[model samples]
Target: MSATLPNGSVLSLATTYGAAIPMTVLTNAAPPVATATAHGLTNGDILEVTSGWLGLDARPARVAGSTTNNFNLEGHDTADTTKYPVGSGLGSVRKVLTWTQISQVMDPATSGGEQRFVNWNYLEDGNASERSKPTNRSAKVLTLKLADDPAQPWNAVLAAADAAGTPRILRLALPGGSFLYYNVYVGFDPEPSLSFNNIMQLTVTLNSAARFIRYAS
Candidate 1:
């Protein structure tokens, strides 16, 4: 029999534990157009920028608007000449989520997936690729099968309905006291298969865009 994690594993945003998301600064627009690539922030979302530009660090700002690859900060009307200056790298920008929100308990049948990339090698005297080599090891992903519960904390994510702007972090603890963390985009599973009076079921795919950091008990 295959062992699996129980349904009680927690899925909470990183902000809940005061962790911040790291973002790369692509444009140093004036206050009216502070820009970063793929920020994953929604309008009115609170953000804290740190460690890139001195002017932006350690300040609480609100997002005015954002596209899939860009975001503009609200109320910052000045630009810094040294903004993202030479030798300066990216900063950390975290979208603050409701830390106090309850976590949604996933139903059974939730499955995990892995994406591994490998490359083949061949010798001039040999046929096709004689051997294979590992290229990249991606994060482990989980598909959450959730019973429809309008009162669940995940309901807020569903109601937001913003994909390009909002992303979250999920922390899952397995039966053996091991933990896995994933930064994911909660695509609104708007169309769940319907049944006759059975409890409604919705499936949300939590793609791990980053490394699956693990912790042991």
Candidate 2:
């Protein structure tokens, strides 16, 4: 068996996005096919999707089975019409063009994303027995503790993202060259923590807008 450490990992934030390509239609299928006239995306291109459907908006997806005018939203399931109504998923998609590394990261903690369930208890059944079904998964939140250095260029990047209040991509690169990418909105405490004999630090929170995407080396 092998183990990987987080010591050599790096975190980066998306800083630039390409021009938005208008998406005309999204089919209700296991993996939704998007229609964009003259879309030049390839099989493995990553796109930030914006849609009228709340479940699909602000989500980052990879392109698959691409054609000149259509591509699949890889791994996205929109087959349930109750959850994703037809004609409500129209929006635009943009390619993430650039990323800026966030340095001086001290400790990173992740929470939530647990599977939630709905429970039911029947009158005929014993009190000890109950039925349960899985519901929607919880969102993941990543909190990063970093040295409070105002001189760092990434500080401005964080501030700008927070001010914009838009969902952007956050990537965590592991030691083995694998990656976990999150679509998130940035927020942070403006005041730094003060402690004697230790360097000042601040906490930045990345609230996920959609499920994280993982890529192998």
Candidate 3:
């Protein structure tokens, strides 16, 4: 015989669940900048510097109504010092993340000419949703690391390999969620004129290209 309680089989119901998996980011977008093993940009993982200058506002577009005016210019203008803005600082250094370091970039059946990486932190270890949820089939994510370099426009990169003047792109999605984007046109910073200052930054004006997501538990 055994002594038992009526509620002995009850189980504790709480929010606790299995450990979440780290979101994986993979891509095959661009040529390896250095070597996968050498630059930590291989096997679908990478660390890159999208900025080339140093300080100024490097993002393509500043947040709407964000009147911080944090933008600044660090050097003197040789052409017209009087016209230079009173508060424009340094720019960004162009950092490139090779193609092998990403899982898969996002792409739509229809498109234009810009290809870039829109989200780097969307899929990571800290986010539970990125690891356990199913990816939305229509999420937009960038295909490669974009350079705000007014010199190396999207046309140049695509033209490098294209004999027919058409651009080719790659697609990949980060597990934690990210944006896939493209460069429409490259030009000087928000400033009125171009200068030799290294502090000038280039910003990527990002727009969604697709809607999709996936989670690994």
Candidate 4:
């Protein structure tokens, strides 16, 4: 007999695996120097930023220079340092989940994208309800059970999300080598329910900012 792993088994280290880290605005120098401690990023690594500055978006930006806690944004300038306020952090940082931190990740699907309508008595409709136009389809909300760990990578990302009001990306590599990616807005520190004998667990609810995409590994 052969044994198989769960389809949703995660296959990446959450600590050292992420596309980008949230950067704290600093100095207001020409080609701003941002702060992200121990970012572990290299020069020329392509980065997509959120509203870290007044005019920044999810545009592809690169790391022109770097230090231990700071990096310079290539070709990005804040002509008036006073106007470009500091402390606006970046988001949409892509990251993976840890095997131990996460107990399970529910499958992704549209929570409620389609709408339905009911026919009136004089409408002469054969059925009680008819399909109405479908609109405002929200992306799937992925729920996860995590063993609360302050040192985990996801916790740091979640802290930035809560403090900066931005979302991050969650990537999952299935057992078959296919990848599932989603932009997740996480809830910071949900109510912890623990017992005197059981392991402490936290329930994290992640709302997908866009539809999940699957790609071959």
Candidate 5:
């Protein structure tokens, strides 16, 4: 989920966690306890305890449970044995923009429906960083803050069989990848639906102008 920290700083699920632990992906209540804002604990975020492994209101740990659960930082899928191995389910698309910036991107949309989806430019999070080790470099994950506007909110675990209602699919298009994996919270069978309730991922592609407007009135 997306939430602005106490410092008025936008903090997504993408944070620094020195170790591994259980990450609680809550779908019902996002506003959180410590703060008043509705925060969404989602991809591109990390969770850990500062005092021990799970502390209350401690550093390096955001109050309440959102992205705090037994994690698999290796970038593996617990179910997908073929694709995402066990040791490769950690880390995901990085946050690219903040909530305020995203608001600007949404201002141009004409339809309240389309406006909810990638109606705004899918500002990428995470960026490549200079490798600390010799002959090694990494990407710097930017901070992204996407919200479930009142217009729409996806709430359900999706599956291949689920094609009736059509849910807003949140896909992370990596720069260099043949296949794209939409962010699935609950997972297949118990497949997690999109964020918006009314919108489902449309296979039909969107034109340049339909997706992004270089100049908006």
Candidate 6:
């Protein structure tokens, strides 16, 4: 077993995205296959998916077994038709084209993504026994504390994203090259905190739109 520290980690934001490739069909199977005519996506390409299925929409999926018209979502499973209904799973995929690094990041905190459950009890139970089943998970929120500098170029980008209120991609690169990517709507707090001698700082909240995708080095 091994572990690595996050001392050298970096954070980046997606600056551009390729045109959406319409997915004609998504199979209900392990490692679900997506059908998109002339997709042109190569194996190992990362795609930002937008689908009708809540479990799949706005998620980042890695591509594999790429063919002219189809490719597999590397580790996704959509076999449970109850959650991912047939004929309603069709959506589009967009490739993240570029990323801009956000420097001077101080402390990053993540919250939420807690799994929710449904509880049930018998109508007439002398023993008072209850059962529970897991349901959908909550979206995560990443709050980043940064040294505020109005002159930073990326500050303008963050402002624009907050103003647009559109979901974009955020990538966190760990020390050993592993990455965690999220689909989020950027929230910028315009006011910075004032202190005695400490550096001026501000916080930016990344409200996740879907589950995060992790890639090992």
Question: Each model's TM-score, in the order given?
Answer: 0.49, 0.79, 0.18, 0.47, 0.17, 0.84
> How do the residues 1-217 of candidate 1 rate in per-residue lDDT, one tens digit apiece?
7576465666554433235656655354554354555656778665555545555454455566677866666655334455556435356666666642325434534334544556566567466755655564444546666677776766665445335544555555667776554455555574555899866677766654543445454
Worst 10 contiguous positions by lDDT, candidate 2: 208-217
Error of 4 at 117 (Å): 5.5
Q: Which residue pairs in candidate 4 collide?
A: none
TM-score comparison, 1 vs 5, better candidate: 1
lDDT, candidate 6, at 42: 91
List, residue by residue over 33-129, the lDDT tens digit for candidate 6. 9999998999877789999988989988888899999999877889999998888889999988888898998888888879999989887865786
The global C-alpha lDDT for each of the candidates, from Candidate 1 onward, is 0.55, 0.88, 0.24, 0.55, 0.24, 0.87
Backbone collisions counted per model: 1, 0, 64, 0, 59, 0
Model 3 spans > 4 angstroms off = 1-155, 158-198, 215-217
Question: How well does candidate 3 match the true structure in TM-score terms?
Answer: 0.18
Clashing pairs in 6: none
What RMSD does each model have against the real structure? 11.6, 3.3, 27.1, 11.1, 21.6, 3.0
Specify the highest-TM-score model's number.
6
Score candidate 2 by lDDT: 0.88
* Model 6: lDDT of residue 9: 90
Residue-pair clash count for candidate 4: 0
Error of 6 at 207 (Å): 1.1
> Per-residue lDDT tens digits of candidate 4, residues 18-119?
554766545466676767788765675434455555455543345658788777655656557467665553543332323223433344333544454443
Error of 2 at 215 (Å): 2.2
Q: Work out how many backbone clashes candidate 2 has.
A: 0
Candidate 1 pairs with clashing backbones: 38-69
Q: Write the per-residue lDDT of candidate 3 for residues 1-217, one digit (tens) a residue.
A: 7453322111110111122111122111121011111122123221111222121122211111111221111121212223323222222212223232221112213333344333433545565433233333442332232333444334343333233322122223333343222222212122222458733333322223222111121
